[model samples]
Target: MRMYEIVLDGELTSDLPATAGPVGRRQEGGSTVLSVPAAGRDALEEVLGLLESLGIGITAMSEVEAPA
Candidate 1:
């Protein structure tokens, strides 16, 4: 499995509805961040889409994977 942590733009989790993301939640200066560990691109995108539906911009994205 792979790990994908999205540092979203503006408030992410707080403003995000219940159906937006997974169980991780954190907050940065002006943006709320959610850490969806061990998630694939498709899964991440689906979460991102849910965020978009709430009118949140995806500021940045980072990916990591377990040692093979």
Candidate 2:
């Protein structure tokens, strides 16, 4: 699975749904950063959709490169 870093506009009031898979969350200033792992693009899209449905706003998203 590929790793992605998603930056939300603000801190999430609750943890991400289990469907999002194992995720890491941290607060960066006023924004919340989430480390999400997905099998592919489609899976990542699904996670994004789920976040939207939960009223979370994404400010930025990018794949995380693995260390050599």
Displacement of residue 55 (Cα, Å) in model 2 is 2.4
Local accuracy of candidate 1 as per-residue lDDT tens digits, 1-68: 56676777776434445554554667888876666656545556678888777677778877766345
Model 2: weakest 10-residue lDDT segment is: 36-45
Best by TM-score: 2
Model 1 lDDT on a 0 to 1 scale: 0.65
Cα lDDT tens digits, model 2, 1-68, are 46788999888767876776677788998899887764556657777898888787899988876344
Candidate 2 deviant stretches above 4 angstroms: 38-43, 66-68
Report how far residue 52 has shifted in candidate 2, in Å: 1.3
- True-structure lDDT of candidate 2: 0.78
Find the candidate with the highest lDDT and give its number: 2
